[model samples]
Target chain A: MTVNGVEQVRDIEPRLLLVHLLRDELRLTGTHWGCDTSNCGACTVWMDGLPVKSCTVLAVMADGRSVRTVEDLEGPFGLDQVQQSFMDCHGLQCGFCTPGMLMTARKLLDDNPDPTDTEIREAISGQICRCTGYRNIVAAIRHAADAEAAGRGDT
Target chain B: MQVPAFFEYQRATSVAHVVTLLERFGPEARIVAGGHSLIPMMKLRLAQPELLVDVNDLHELAGITVEDGVLRIGALTRHAELLASPLAGEHFPILHDAERVIADPVVRNRGTIGGSVCQADPSEDLSGVFTALRAVAVVRGVDGDRTVPMREFFHGPYETAVRPAEILVELRVPLQPGAGSAYVKVDRRVGDWAVAAAGAVVSLGPGGVVEQVGIGLTAVGDADFTAVEAEDLLRGRVADEYTFAAAGEAAATHCRPVADQRGPVDYKRHLAGELTVRALRDATARAHRGGSTE
Candidate 1:
């Protein structure tokens, strides 16, 4: 499986979930595993550029697919604009749901960079965050949009 | 941690290979496409298959097209794809409305329309929607292909007419000209299973009278989950408040719902009537002219 821009081939069981493949074998712990069921979006990752719960997906399904996890969002220079916006808007409180939020949020910005507050909520409706309410997450997504728009202006 | 029982996973490249694999493995083998439904069932120990034929790589069966005045949807079409397809939205708003709330977008990315239809759960939204539209399921076996009407497709909860060694390949919905359809589900929250849902397709004739109609309810048990008696009354009658009310009462009387967590028998029955009326009204209005997409 090619994950986070690296191709790591290994023999694994068919029942092995993509979440375990990343956390155990690849040691890419940035993607947290929560709610073994597909209910919680904490295990979300970009499969073929779309957000899908890794816990529900088998590792073999990702054999030839390019998977982009939250780890890939970090640039060599610093945090990506969406990741930075989360910190700036204080999108995290308990931090358990941050990785999934970040990954889903990045995809939202990629598809609809200037999503409205309602659109952001609808996009992350699958995710559950107990500590920090969704108000800040919506703000964080908006912050990323503003930053991206400002970046485009500078160029 | 939840994990499926030990099983051999074989990937099938084409529908023919899948048929061959089904014959090879017998009834103990099951096809795994999106794995959204089967995997969870496996983890919960509800379903244990000796072998799984992974059909995710079968690109041929993954298609959605409308031709010959019929919307032909390949069994492998993903929920996200169905929801995003403008052609589907233009033709059947019921599908789009139900898809939006079937599950979260993350799950929709992998869940197939075939998986939802084949699940055959009584509370499943698509079943009611398809039933109202009078859609048909195409089942392919080693012999040949057979079409089963939606009314006869579902045998019982979690059971369909698709026999062993036969796979549901496609769903065909005959296009309704000068007609509009709508689905209304009243769930406790979005993405949750329906507490009680209703869908209706109405076509008006001269003098704003309902020429044809199909009504279906979910979570509230009725014969075939359809308000056939109600549709009978509504057809050839002016689709006004009085007729709609009468039809709703007929629907409420026909369904036999059971008490559960979402609501009691009485409440669900009430929703069956209420939603039926609401769906009928919206569908009739849209048949005249498009209204709010939602």
Candidate 2:
């Protein structure tokens, strides 16, 4: 199966989780596994344009699906608007939940470009940021929105 | 978490293939759809089957349609499809309400309704709502097809009446006029499993008297329970606050709950009563063409 614009094929066990395949086989470790159980959203990734918990998904389940990881977010110059906005707005301190947080935010914004604070909170509720950087996260989303509205680069 | 090493995997392309596989494998094998529930249990090593037959690729096992005033949902219909289905939103309001709050959006997208009903988790929302709505499960085996009422289909926690070789093919819920139903659940988070929930289906006569009342409770027993006493008490009565409160009390009295990690048994009882009252109130209000907000 092709992942993150790369065509790849390999035989895998039925028990091999997609997170393991993305990390161990594919050498893409950006998707961290904070909770092997489905509770924690640390392994969130976009499969076929919808956000799903990677830890809960089997590698076989993703056989014919398009997967987008945090590694795919790197641009020609620097970090994407969502990532930079998280930094500028202080959305992270421990950064354990950063990749999943960023991926979830990307899907949320794609669906609703100008989401309300409640919408942002609901979008990221699956992920738990231990440092409780929610306040700054919200601010950064708003800042990114403002930048987009002003036709300036996203902070 | 690793799936136990004992099981063998077989991906079947059609329903006949699944049936043949199951018949050949016998009771040691289980059919897997979506893998939202089975895979998790396998990872935890809670359920160790010798063989797993993947039925997700069977196209005949997925889809949604309405026929003869009854909504027929294929067994593999995902929660997301139900949420997005116009038939569910139009004909089965109780199911729509429950499906809207199941797990989360991602889980909803992948978790199949059949998988959930077959899993028979007491805390699952759809099972309770389906029971209250008097839905039927269509099962297919070597002898052909049989329809099992939702109440009879669900035996207990993690248990169903489906035979070892039979495949659950579809869920059928009748569409009745003058029927208004609502499901109310309390959870720590919006999409978490219910601490306790109640699905109330109330249809009233022209004189504003209840014609039929079906109340199903979850997270309070081994399986979704029909509150027969509550239904008997509310029949032919005006669905007022007093009547609903009485019905709620009756339902709570019949509930056999236990304390789990979420909360104490007493708290579940209290929540069950509150949710029952709330669901009835909302259902009645909707029947009268009023919004639940009131």
Q: Could you list the iRMS of every candidate?
A: 0.8, 2.2
lDDT of 2 by residue, B82-144 (tens): 888876777657887898678876677678999998999989888888888899999998888
Off by over 4 Å in 1: B290-294
Candidate number of the best TM-score: 1
Question: Which candidate leads the pack in DockQ?
Answer: 1
The window of 10 residues in a row where model 1 chain B has the poorest summed lDDT is B285-294
Cα shift from native, residue B226, model 1 (Å)? 1.7
The native-contact fractions of the candidates, in order shown, are 0.62, 0.24
Q: Give one digit per residue, the lDDT tens place, for model 1 in B88-132.
A: 888888888788888888889899989888887789888898899
Question: Which pairs of residues collide in model 2?
Answer: none
Task: Point out the worst 10-residue segment of candidate 2 chain B by lDDT.
Answer: B285-294
Q: Which candidate gets the maximum lDDT versus the true structure?
A: 1
For model 2, the stretches where C-alpha displacement exceeds 4 angstroms are A76-78, A145-155, B1-6, B222-224, B290-294
